[model samples]
Target chain A: MTRLEDMVGAAVRDLADSAPNAHDLASVARVRGRRIRRRRQALLGAAAVVLAGAVITPYAVLDGWNGGPRPQPVASVPPSTAPVVPVPSTVATAPAIRKDWWAAPVRLPGDLVVTSVGRREVNGPNGVTAVAPKTVQEGNVALDRSTGRYRAFSGGYQGFDGAPAGRYVMTDDGITAQIGILDSVTGQTRQLGHGSGRGVEWSADGKTLLLSLLRGGVRLIDAKTGAAVDREMPDAIALCPSYCNFTWLPGGEEIAIAQRDPRVERSEALPDTVRDIRVFSVATGKPLRTLPVPGVPAGSAAWSPDGRYVALLPDAAEEDGIRIAEVATGRIVATLPLVEQVRFIADDQILTVRGLDVGVYDLTGKLRQSSRLPQDFLGRGISLGRA
Target chain B: MKQSLEDEFTAFVADRGQSLLRIAHALTGDRESAQDLVQGALAKAYARWPRIHGDAEAYVRKIIYNDRASAWRRPGRRNEVTVAEVPDRAAAGRHDQDVTDRIAVREALLSLPERQRAVLVMRYLEDRSVEETAEVLGCRPGTVASQASRALNKLRLLVGDRPVSMGGAR
Candidate 1:
C-alpha cells in the first residue's frame, strides 16, 4: 500500500474507534420510529372511524323519521314558458381580477410611506410578548400595488416583543427627526429625536444614529441628545443633489450610501444612469472609497459583515442576481444566481421566494430545504426566526 | 412486530454506520456534515420502511449518493470545503496502523469528483461487485466499470509511491 492509502486507512479506523456518542444516532432512530408509529396509528384509526361511521349513519338517519310512507315527486314548470334569453359568452366572462388584490389589505400608516419592513422581537418582564401575529406590521408605510400607489395607513405600532429593549429610530420625509423608545414592561412608546431624512440606521451599541440628508451628505446624530455630530461628509461625497440611501454595517463605524454623482453625470431630470456605492466613516463623514458593482446597474446596495461584500439589486424590472465585491481588492468574488427577488437570511444563507415555494440555499449553491406558503401568504413577504 | 429486525438494525448500525460515514465523510470532508448526510439517508429509508426494509442498507446508500449528486447541480451554490486537522506526527504515533491508513485514504478520496469518489467507495472499500455498484449509482454496469477504472487510476497517483502493507491482506 502507498503512504496515502495507509494514512487514510488509519484515519477511518481511528474515527470508528472513537465514534461519537450514540445519543444522536439513537435520537434520530427514535424520532423516525415515532413518526412511523404515529402515521400507522393515524391510518388505522381513520380506517376504523370510516368503518364505524358507515355502519352507524343509516341507523341514526332511520331513527330520526316519524312517518315511513313517502309521496312521489311533482313537476313544477314546462320548458316552453321559460324566457328565451340569448347568453353572450363575451358578456358572461368574469372581469380580470388584479393579481395584487390578495396583498391589498396590508396597509402602511398614513403620513409614512413604508420604505422598508423588518421583523424584530423584544423581550421584557411581560413573559415574551406573544410573537406578534403573522399579519402584524413592524415598520411604517404600506406599499400598495393595487393602483400602483404608495399610501400611509395606520396599524403598525412598534412595541417590545421578546427582543432586547432598545430605542428604535424612525425617519420622516427622508429625515431622521422622530425617535421612539419602547418601555420594556409597559410596552409604551416615547419620542426622542427630531430630524428628517429618507433613511435612518442605529449604531451597533444603539448609542449613535446615522441619517442621510435628501439634498446632500450624511449626518451623525447622538441617539440620546438628538444633537448632530460635528462630523459631516466631505463635499465630494456630499455632491448627491437628489436622492440617497444609506446602509450601516453591524460595527456602526462605517456606512455605505448609493447616490448619483452630480459632477460626472448631468441631466435636466434626476439622471437614472448615475449610481455608485461609497463607504464613509460614520464619525468623520470622510469618504473612504467608492466601489463600482459590476453587472448591476445600481439602485440599492447593502453591506455584508466586515464590509467585505456589498449586495446590489436593480429596480423591479431588472433580472436578479447578487454581486459580491471584495472591499480591499474591489474585485468581484461571486455573482449569486437568484430569482427576481431574494432576501438575505445571513452572511451565508439566502431565503428566496419563487412562485409558491420558499427555498433556502447556502452561499455555495446547495439547496437546504423548501417549504410551500399558504395561498393567502403567497404574495406577502416572509420573515423567519428560530422557533 | 419483530424484535429480531430491530436488533438487526441496531447491529447493522453498529457494524456498518462507520463504513457509511467514511464514504459520506469522504464526499463532504467534514465529520459533522457526514453525520447529517447519513442521518438524512436513514430517515428517507425509514419513511419507506415497508418497501425498503427488505433492502434497507442498499436503499439508504442510494439516498446518500443521490442527495450528494443533486446538491452539486444547484446554480450559484458554493461548497464550503472544511479540511480535517492533521494531528502532529509524534502525537499520531500512538494510533493503530489501520487507523492511520484509513485517514490517508479519506483525504485522498476527498480529492476526487462526487461520481468518481462514490464509485471507488462502493467498489473497493465496500467490496461491492461492479454490477452492484452500478445498481446503487443508477448507471450501466459498463459505465460503472469505466468510472471505477478511472477512479482507481487516480487513486494510484494520489496515494503516491510509498509502500505499506495491508494489515489483513497479502
Candidate 2:
C-alpha cells in the first residue's frame, strides 16, 4: 500500500479499536424493523398478517402504525356497543414495554371504529391521560397520535387548524369536509353540521369553525349549533394574486397573515411578498397591528400554541432550519432541524419527523421523546397532527 | 411468516451489526452519529425486506455511504469539524508521535470531505477495491480512485509526517 494508504489504515484502526459491540444496536434495530415494516405495509391495508410483538412496546415511537386492521366506520352505533377487547393474554407474563407519558400504542383491530371526534378521557396504561379517539375498543386503539382511533378521519389540513384531535373537519370526496365535535369524556359524536366553507378551521375553544371561502371571504360556523356567520376580507388582504397563508391565534380573536407579492410572480424573492406581516382582527375583519417579518415566503408561517411565536421554515435565501420568532419581538430565539415536518405539539414542545423518527422536543431544544418510523413514512403519509 | 421474517432480520443484525457499527464510526467519527446513521439505514432496509433480504448488509452499507455524503451537503446541518488550525510546518523533523498526534491524525481524517473520507475508509481500512468502493458510492471507479488520492494527500499534510506511523498504539 502507498504511504498515505497505510496512514489511512492506521487512523481507521485507531479510531475503530474502541468501538462498542453491536448487540444493543441489534435489539433496537429489530424493533425498528418490525415497526417500520408494519408502517410500510399499512399502505397496502391490514389484510397482510404482520405478527404482533409478544409484548408490544408502549411508547416505542410513531404513535399510529396500523399493522393489525383498519377499523370500519360505524357512526350510528355507540362506541361501547362493539365487543369489549380482552386484555392481551401476554400482559401478565410479558416483559416490560417502554411507556410514553401520552399514550400506550397498541395494535388496533378492525372493529373499534371511530366515526367522529369525541372527548373521552382515556387513561392510558401507566398514567397516560388523553382524549381517546372514539373507539369501541378504547383500551386497544392504534398508535395514531393525531386522531387516536378515528376511522372516518378521511382528510383535513394537517397541523394547520389542529384538526383530528377533539374536533376535526374532514372531506372524503375532496369536494366537502365538515367539522365534527365529540365529547372528550364519553367519546360520543356531537352532530355539528357540515361547515359550509372551504378551508375550515376549528377555533382554539373548539366552539367555532373558521373557514375560508373561494368566492373571496372567511366564515365562522358554530361547531355546536351549526350557526353560520360570514365575514369578507378587506380588499387589502383579499385577491390572492400570488398566494395567502394564515393561522388563527390562540384567543381565536385574531389571525397572522402572510401575503406574497402579486407583481413579482416568482415566490422566493424578498420583493415578491409584503415586507410586514398583517395581523387581522376576526371580529372586525380589518388589518390589525402590522409586524415586520421581512423575507418570509408564502405558506410557511405556523403559530405556536401559546400564540407568542410563529415557527417559520427556511425561505430560499435563509438557513435551512426551523426558525421560531417571538411574535412581539420578531426576534428568532431558536433554529432547529425538521423544518418541513414541524408542529408545536405543546406550548414549548414541538412534534417533528427527523429522518425515520417522530420526536418530541421541548422549548429549550431538548429532545424529550423520539421514535423512528419508516424512511418513507412522511412520503407515504404516516398520519401526523391533521391530515 | 412474520416471526420468520423477523428472525431473519434479527440474524442479519446479530451477525453483521458490530462490523457495520465499526464502519459507521470510522465514517462519522462519533458514536452517536454513527448509531443514528446505522439506525436510519436499517429502518429503510427493514421497510424493503423481501426484495433485498438476500443481501441486506451490502444494501445498508451503500445507504450509509450515500447518506453520509448527503449529510455533508445539507444546509446548516452538516457536521462541522472544528479543529485547532494545523501548524504551517512541523518543527523540522521533530514531530512527536504521541496520543496528541494520533488525535490530530483522526481529526485530519475526519476533516476531509465526507465522500473522500468514506473512499479512504473503503479502499484502505475496509480493504475494498476501487470498483467495490465505486459500487457502494454509486460512482465510477476512477472517481473513487481520485477521491482516495486527494484524501490521502490531505491527510499527509495535516498529520505532519512524510510516512505517518501505522503502529496500533492509538
Candidate 3:
C-alpha cells in the first residue's frame, strides 16, 4: 500500500466509522426539492412581472439580450473542472420533452393570461420580522433576467423617502425589524416600520394588504384608500405564523385560512399543527367554506382558475403529494404522485417539480411533458419566455 | 425497485448518510460546512433518483466532488479550509490509527487546493484511476493526471515520505 493510500484510507475509514446521521439525504432531498420548486415558480412569476414592467420601464423593453438569441443545445460540451465556463456563447436546449427537457426563451405574448396567483411577485426589495424564534433580517432582491422584476431572497426594503407606494409584497427581513415595500415599477424599497417587522402581503387585486401588528393580532388594510378592511381578521384559531398565511380565492373577496386545533388527529402526511382549512369572507370575515380536514394537515391551498377545485399541499412533513378537492363539497377529487412543490401554469395545466426536472401535468394528474432546465437555473438568474 | 422512492431514499440516508457526512467533514474541515456540503449534494442526487438510482452512490459522490471543486473557484471560500486537529488514535476509536502519520497526511492534504484535495481523495483513498477520476470530475484524463501528480508531489514534500501510486489503485 502506498503511503498516500494509507493516509487517505486512514482518514476516510475513520470518517466512515465516526460519522453520524447528522442529516438525512432523503429528507434533505425533499426539502431541497421544495426549495427548487419555489425558486422555479418565483422565476416564472418574476418573468411575468418583468413582462409587465416591459410596458412601464423603458430600458427594460430595449434590452436586446433579454430574449433576443434563440437557445439551441450542442451535442456535447467539453469537460472542464472550472465552475464557470463562458456562457457557451450558445445556449443549450434539451433534446426532447421526455428525453431531455428544455425551457427556451421565446417571444411570450404581450398579453399574459394568469390563471392563479402563487408566490409573492419578484418586486424588488423588502424587510421582514419573524415572530417565532424571534429575529430581524434585512432583505435582498435579485432581479430577473427580464426587466423590473426581483426576488427578495434576503436583504431589506429600500426607497422610503421619495418613492411611489402602490402595494409592495413583503416578507420578514429581520435585521432592521422594519417592514419594507418593494415597488413593482421601479426596483426600490421603502420602510413601513421597525416594530412588528414582517412584510404585509398584498391582495391579488393589489387593493388589500395583510398586516400583522406588533401590538396585537393580524389586520387587513385597503391599500388604495388606506382603510382597515378588518382590524382583526378574526384569527379565532390563532393558526397564523408571525404574519398569517391565506390562499386567495378567485373572486378576491374570500380567502382560505389555516385554523389550528391540537385535538385534530393527523397522519404522518399532515403538518402537526393544522386541524382544519377554512374559507372566510374578506367582506364579513365569516366562514364561507369549512374544508373537511383530511387525516392530514393541508398547508398550501391553491384555488383553481374556474373556482371548481382547490389544490392542497400538505404542510412540510412528508412527500405526500398534492390533493385536489372540490371547492363546494370539499371532497378530494384526485391525489397526485409524490411531488415536492406545485404551481398552476394554465387553467387546465399544473406545473410540478419531479426531482431536478419540471413536469407539466394536466388536471387529471397525467404528466404531459417534462423539461430539463439549464444546469445552473435558479430564481435570480433564469427565466423562460413562452411563445 | 425493491423499495418505494421514499423507502429507498430513506435507506440510503440511514445507511450511507454518516459516511458521506464524514467525507464531507474531512473535506470542509468544519462540522456545519460539512453538513451543508453533504446535504446539498444529497439533495441534488435525490432529485434524479429515478434515473440515477442504479448508481446512486457514485452519482452522489460525483456531486460532492464537483460541488467542492466548484467551491474552490469562488473567491471567499478557499480560506475556510483548515488543517484539522491532530486526531488521538484512541479518539479515532481504533488502536491502529497512527497519530503522527494521520496528522502528517491531514496537513499535507489540507496544504493542497480543493481540486487537488478532491482528486487525491478519489485516487488514493477511494482507489480511483486516472480515467475514472477524470470521468467523475468531468475533466480530461490529462487534467486528472497532472492534478494527481502535483498533489502527490506536494504530499511527498510535506510529509518527507515515499508516496505510493496505485494505478490499479481503485
Best by lDDT: 2
Clashes of 1: 48
Query: Which 10 consecutive residues of model 1 chain B have the lowest summed lDDT?
Result: B73-82
Fnat for the candidates in order: 0.13, 0.34, 0.33
Worst 10 residues of 3 chain A by lDDT: A53-62
Rank all candidate structures by their lDDT, best first, as comma-separated numbers: 2, 3, 1
lDDT of 2 by residue, B20-139 (tens): 878888887665456656866776677677878998988888877766322311111223243343334434444354444556667788777667878877866788888888888767
Candidate 1, lDDT over the whole model: 0.40
Report the C-alpha lDDT of model 3 over B45-116, residue by residue, as the tens digit.
665667777878887777777663223111112212223333323435334446756766665575566677
Q: Which scores better on TM-score, 2 or 3?
A: 3
Better of 1 and 3 by TM-score: 3
Off by over 4 Å in 1: A1-185, A192-197, A204-207, A221-230, A234-243, A259-276, A292-301, A315-320, A333-347, A351-359, A364-368, A371-387, B1-170
Off by over 4 Å in 3: A1-171, A194-201, A211-217, A221-229, A233-235, A238-244, A260-262, A265-270, A273-275, A293-301, A315-319, A337-341, A353-356, A372-376, A379-387, B1-170
lDDT of 2 at A357: 44
lDDT of 3 by residue, A161-188 (tens): 1111122333324344344544434545
Tell me candidate 1's interface RMSD: 17.7
Interface quality of candidate 2 as DockQ: 0.15
